[model samples]
Target: MADVHKVVFYPVGNGDTTQIVLSGGRRVLFDFCHRERAEDTDTPEIDLKSRFKDELKAVDRDYFDVVAFTHADLDHIQGSTDFFELQHAKKYQGEGRIKIRELWVPAAMLLEEADKDHQQEEFVLLRQEARHRLLEGKDILVFSKPKALADWLEPRLNERGEAASARDHLFIDAGTIVPGFSLASDGVEFFCHSPFIKHCDEGDIIRNRASLVFNVRFLADGAYYDYLEVGDATWEEMEDIVRTTRYHKNDDRLAWDLYNIPHHCSYLVLNEEGQKGDKETEPKPLVKELLLQGKRDAYIVSCSKPIPDIKESYEQVQPPHIQARNTYERYLKEVGGRKFLVTMEEPNANKPEPIVFEIASGGVTWKRSASIGAPAIITSTPPRAG
Candidate 1:
């Protein structure tokens, strides 16, 4: 087949680290949360950073073309500075770490006066890197510039006498397309959908509300494969996205072959009351209707611990909630789907393998090389993950 293009979802516990290897070895990482060695018995003992390096070699690429941070959550941005080569660009190079040629971040991450009460060290570093890259005129696309932030920058631009287009190439608005990649050749196209002005203009930083949700599409033989990944988005935001996209006749962007279940399968994406005293909460009608749009053979993969049927207190409710998984399961049933992969669970082994979703002419399928593990569903070298 043509050179393989795939998306590998690492088995990080309740966190995300998805690597999208487009055709021609162009790499785009969604988020990063690496395991140092081995934390628990449920996950494999493979070093995630090392595994990524080996995969990069297979594609014969030395740097990540893009690294998109959905939001500044510790779970999403953790271990990023140590893993990727950030500042080793535009200067001396000796092969130290994976260089990030381009960065995609929401405006909240770059807000100069952001509320630091909840900032994580990794997130702080990531934000600083984005800021530095923008100042250097690098390929840094600020995902969504709310009117507040945009207004906040107008004076600075006037003072510096910088033309509107002087930085328009780097600053982006929501619902607009992101550049620096193509679909026909790169095998992928990204459409921005989040960091709404309302989300950013709030008094307190609602971190999750500022996430950069995208209708990430992969093209193959003129056909498009869609995957929706929203980091920690609540049901309110999810509903608005569905209604807005459909209202604007952007339904084509919502179709998906494989869905990376958002918020680690949390019910917050379904409704505010994810659980009610050990009993799962019911999803709203619109949320249910939206999920019914899944394509045939669609799969929902949750990258978290086992979605337990029991409930926990709201104060300590970890994501990948069993109730939410049940919701996705029912939706899959509607679409004649039979697979719902959990990252921490093995196909039939002591550890979990990187769930690989390969995009080919026929359709999407999951395959595992002999090194990492085996696929419980279809097999065909979907994409090997250690």
Candidate 2:
């Protein structure tokens, strides 16, 4: 084998769950959406708990190198508390629960205040776990140290008889490559692109605005391929990222070979709020530029339900919107890109499998499954210059 890497996107139906297996055995999972109904075996959603456990068992492992929770949204963190062993509480430990060697979360996860009625939600529990690890000063990475987080953390550190800035190294900011992983050694480097300080520091905390976004660059035979794993960011945040990234001369971070489109292909990510007048939502000026940054034979993956071209679908309010999908397909065609894949519609909506992309020295290749009724298909894009 030629040191191939794998990126797997699950069919979570408008939710987000992506796993990146490095050329080495190390794995990093972004978001986790495990529906309870999936256990029935009849639901379209995969049984994430069973699949993840089986996958880890095949390798004789019990933990992930990095488990990043982009935001505390239900779709992103649903059923996560029951799946991963929480170091903060003994009740959540043991029983074959998967361990996270290093947990990654945005500052919002630490500072957000839960509503009284939703205080016991999974997001709150995950926040407690993240806070515990951060306080312990080990096995955790907190993205962006906004003032709100600092205010909360400084008092806690003071109570523990430690310097307020003691845990600064663990905090990663936007536009910088995450430490501990380098292309030279790990064949991958994550460049933080969003969840800037302002996003969290401003008056009220919006989960989507404070979500984590990264440009994951994979190195293979001296060539670099980018994967943009954006959370449920809206058009305002997208524009901010474009303006700030370009202003700082970090334009290359905008380029992507594999783009996980934001908000389950929601038009709000491409157009301004209340601007869906056109049947096909046109991408905002900066967003269009970002789409154009897709490299040759690039792919845009939508981690959402099937986007049908039916009459009722056009007027659908929620995500997996047909209009947004149309815009993405248009841009993919304009750029001569490879495919626009939907998680729940890959092979078929009834029993969709994970969309796997293998990265090798040659280039990226889509690994298609040949189920009984599904077509046997395998597509590989040509290698690009480093």
Clashes of each: 2, 0
lDDT of each: 0.72, 0.89
Q: Which is the leading candidate under TM-score?
A: 2
Instruction: Write candidate 1's Cα lDDT for 163-183 as tens digits.
Output: 545666787766766776678
lDDT per residue (tens digit) for residues 22-133 in model 2: 9888999999999999998889999999999988887889999999999989999999999999999899999999999999999999987878898779989999999999
lDDT of 2: 0.89
Q: On a 0 to 100 scale, what is the lDDT of residue 333 in model 1?
A: 86
Model 2: weakest 10-residue lDDT segment is: 369-378
